[model samples]
Target: MNAHDPIRRCILLGERAPRESLIRLALSPDGAVFPDVRAKAPGRGAWIGVTRAELESAIAKGKLKAALARAFKTGPIAIPDDLPDMIAAALERAVLDRLGLEARTGNLLTGAEKIEAAARSGKLHLLLHAADAGTDGNRKLDQAWRVGKDEEGSDLRGLALPVPRTILAVALGRQNVVHIGLTERDAARRVSETLTRWLHFIGSHPALPTCETVSQGASALQIIPTGAGNSVADDDTCEELE
Candidate 1:
């Protein structure tokens, strides 16, 4: 409920946001930082990050404008489409960071190694897998479940500094990380939210696919067209972003 969440602020400030300590608001969600959620323009700033459904609900009920009005310390800044992409991106980065760390520290176990290691370990505080993994691998996990980035660090392996997509971006001295496990401290909690993002699209499977870009499953990944329609919510050509 806290409006000034750092990640949400990052969404507001986009690239213009300072990465370090506390800073003031940026232009808007539809600014250069991201081309989505164009409604938050030219007006003052307010932060709100709970859940996409919740935000959408607020919009449906008109509570969104009321809250923004009070928070902006004035009348509400015009909130365009309640595009939660900024929040979604933040969550996605969180997942990538976790996957990256598991790759870096040797904790992330992909392929058969993930299942073999988990089986050998017995009961786990948390379980994880991509939403898109095959049914064959899915059957292998005793209690394998989908994990979100928010759940990465705490319930699963303890990681420090969260997951970094760079680890995944670079070849493991060879190929980028398709799968990994986090067994190190500091890195565990950092990657929870990130993992949650992955679980959103890829379901939780016991073993990581032998390859990246796993096959899709029953998960509600494309619940809506991302980015494509945000700028044009009410048939308006997203003036804020342009």
Candidate 2:
């Protein structure tokens, strides 16, 4: 949608969508196929516009294999039986890698007190809770976020990440990271969009609204409005919890 967002046609759906919204699958020189979730892989690539379930359906019906053969103009590219699992794992790693990068860049704050203070000060763009975090703690933080935004009249946002505490702590290189706050809007968008895609891929519908809904202020998590031209492809990764 934006100047930098490229449009690619999905080989399966034949529909043109922003590159970020489609999944990229690349063929290596030796004819091996791998899911290029980051879209930075080398060699020729094909795009698919379907969700994970749809992709699985395509595989089940032999459509994906046939389509890939046609796209690559090859006879048969030994499609891995666990191709879906491979893509899922790669996406998960990409999400965790991005989180780690954010932590290293000091754009992320962990720990309840630090996150709460950031939220209270209206400096937090997003608040992320681990999936396995206690309901009491989650409620307390949600209340704090609401109170802080109410006081400042700011429309910040928060969500429960699909990742559990153990994965979050490991990703952040911390001991126990139950909660996290992102102070940067770009970082928050990246994290949220990636997580959303992952959840969709795994057939898990999150309770939160889509980014557009959040940006429109139609949801409880008042996200800062990103311009209309931004597309889902702007978020570079995807995955679900184990």
Candidate 3:
């Protein structure tokens, strides 16, 4: 979504809310995802992340109940026992498991410097910009976008890197990339699924624009070292294709 554009505040809530039975919250905001730890019961939802502390804070402050009532413009409903933690853990595990799978498949790129190079190459179908990474890191890497050459072979610089917090970086990745990029068709599909969960569990945020391709050193990708596969230093981009 455009940064300045009004974010579509729709929620992608779960089929079952994290609350007592009969209580339900919808996750659609305007168009995409939203976290709703608070107000996740018996009414409309207030978006929240998949963090345990946030859930606890909501419970302690009564924010969870109040928000639900506020969203519904009604009275408060009871919060379920440990529902917040359960929800957060569930979300966290699901996110990490997916990332691990992608990592194993040679689809995912972790580590900042590694992806930074990828960002520069314009080879990225998606740049998994970390939600927690500072504005500067986000900006610098986002700068890697070189607009695609137009029909006249003139550089338009029109193309910007698509940075979707659109995807999630998780507590599991350990640092914070809950962020992920996608290039291949299958990987992109997994990215989409991950994106849906992010939207459903995490609230809306401004995502960066997308870039085209990143040129690598070799005409073909060579053998890449593990643990560095997600590294910007890895020179295996076209090698796999070759």
- Runs in model 2 deviating more than 4 A are 151-157, 207-242
Evaluate model 3: give its TM-score: 0.40
Sorting all predicted structures by lDDT, with the top scorer first, yields 2, 3, 1
Which candidate has the highest lDDT of all? 2
lDDT by residue (tens digit), candidate 2, 53-128: 8888999999988878777775458677888898878777877888899999989999888878877776777777
Candidate 1 lDDT at 242 equals 31
Q: Please provide, for model 3 over 1-242, each residue's C-alpha lDDT reduced to its tens digit, 9 standing for 90 to 100.
A: 11221111211121211121111234343322233322332323343333345456666877666555544443435566666555645554555566567766777775657665664564545555554456666554445533211122322121121333334433323445534555454564454444434333433322322222322211111222333323121211111111
| TM-scores, all models, native as reference | 0.45, 0.80, 0.40
- Highest TM-score against the true fold, candidate: 2
Order the candidate numbers by TM-score, best to worst. Answer: 2, 1, 3
Q: Candidate 1 on 1-242: residue-level lDDT in tens?
A: 01131222222212221111111122354332222222234544444333456556776787755554444444225554524555455445555654555656765555546544653464222334443444455444422422322232222222122233344445234243333444443344344433433343232322222112222232222122333322221211112223
**RMSD of every prediction:** 13.4, 6.9, 17.5
